[model samples]
Every structure is written in C-alpha cells, then in structure tokens.
Target: MMNRNFNRRKKFIFFLPVAVLIVAVLGYVVMFLWNWILPEVAHAGKLNYWQALGLLVLCRLLFGNFNKGGGHNGFRERARGMRAKWDSMNEEERAKFKEEYKRRCGGWGHHRNKE
Candidate 1:
C-alpha cells in the first residue's frame, strides 16, 4: 500500500507539469485567435493572456466535460435502457405507451386540419 501510494504520487507529480503546460498552450492559442480575429470581425475587444485563460476555463465549465473518457456515453446508456424496456414490453403495452406519449406530447409535429 505504501509503495502504491508513492507510485501514485510520483505519477501525479510528473503529470501535473505536463497538464499545466498543455492548458497554458491552449490559453495562448485562445488569446491569439481572439486577438487576431474577433477584434476585426466581431468588433470585440482584445483579450489579454489571463482573460483568455479565464475565458477558456469558463467555457470548459459551461459547455465542456472534464471526463477522461468523454463521449455520449450517458445518452447511449439511457437509450440502451429505453431499448431494453421497449423490447420487454408486450404489443398491447407498447401501443398503450405510444398512445399515452402521443396524448402527452401531441404526436410528432403533424398538424391536423380541422374542417
């Protein structure tokens, strides 16, 4: 256990600098792009390095995931669960479910012309 902890600490120490460097590079890229393009095209003010870095962090928090193995896994899992439930449903149950869904959601955007 001691050895394992030491190894983990060593790895973290080694990778921390790399991670920081990568984030710094990304921040510089963001700063460069915003300074080069947005000031001219969007009439936006130029961002300094720190502001660009903060913006990068803000965007990540708002719209990005920090997961290492990121993908649509959550959506896929939900879809898989729904598929399993649908497969297990009988025809009558499925029809009833569809009717309930249609009743709740007003069908699939098709409009009926009432004469």
Candidate 2:
C-alpha cells in the first residue's frame, strides 16, 4: 500500500510540470489568436500573455464548472446518493413512496389533471 501510494505521488509530481507547461502553451495560443483575430475583426485591444491567462481564468470562472463535485456542497453527489437509496428500496417501499408523492402532489401519467 505504501509503495502504491508513493508511486502515485511520484507520477503526480512528474506530471505536474507537464500540465503547467500545457496550460502555459494554451495561454500563449489564446494570446496569439486574440491578437490575430479580435483586434482586426472587432476593433478590440490587443492582449499580452498574462492578460490572456487572466482572460482564460475569467472565462473559466464565469462559464465553466471544474469543481469535481466540490462546489454546491456536492449536490450532484448527494443526488447520486439519493438515487442509490431509491434503487435499494424494496418493491413495497418504492410503491408506498410513489403513492405518497402522488397523494401529496399530483400523480404521473393519466392521473395528471387535463385542465
């Protein structure tokens, strides 16, 4: 177990620099593209490498979710857990739960109100 853990750590350490280098290359690509296209097409200001990196981060913050279920307090994970619980329920319990939901709210299928 210790050897396995150490091997994993060694791999991570080895890959970390490569990952950073990839990200830096991508940032430079972004800078190049923005400078190449946007300034001429949109009359936008040119961006330096650092500005491009900042733009990458800003776009990630605004439009991306990379939390691996960390944000929202693991809401997706909790949803999966609830699904597992439902799957583990016996037939009677499942039927009873469905009936209770239909009673309190509305039913599925034909039970729905036409109006």
> Who wins the lDDT comparison?
1
**1-115: candidate 2 lDDT, tens digit per residue:** 9999999999999999998998899899999999999999999999999999999888777766445642366678799998999999999999999988776678455465444
Clashes of 2: 0
Candidate 1 regions off by >4 Å?
69-73, 107-115
In terms of lDDT, the poorest run of 10 residues in model 2 is 65-74
lDDT of 2 at 51: 98
In angstroms, the error of model 1 at 73 is: 7.4
lDDT of each: 0.87, 0.87
- Cα displacement (Å) at residue 52, model 1: 1.5
TM-score per candidate: 0.75, 0.56
Q: Backbone clashes per model, in order?
A: 0, 0
Q: What's the alpha carbon RMSD for model 2?
A: 7.4
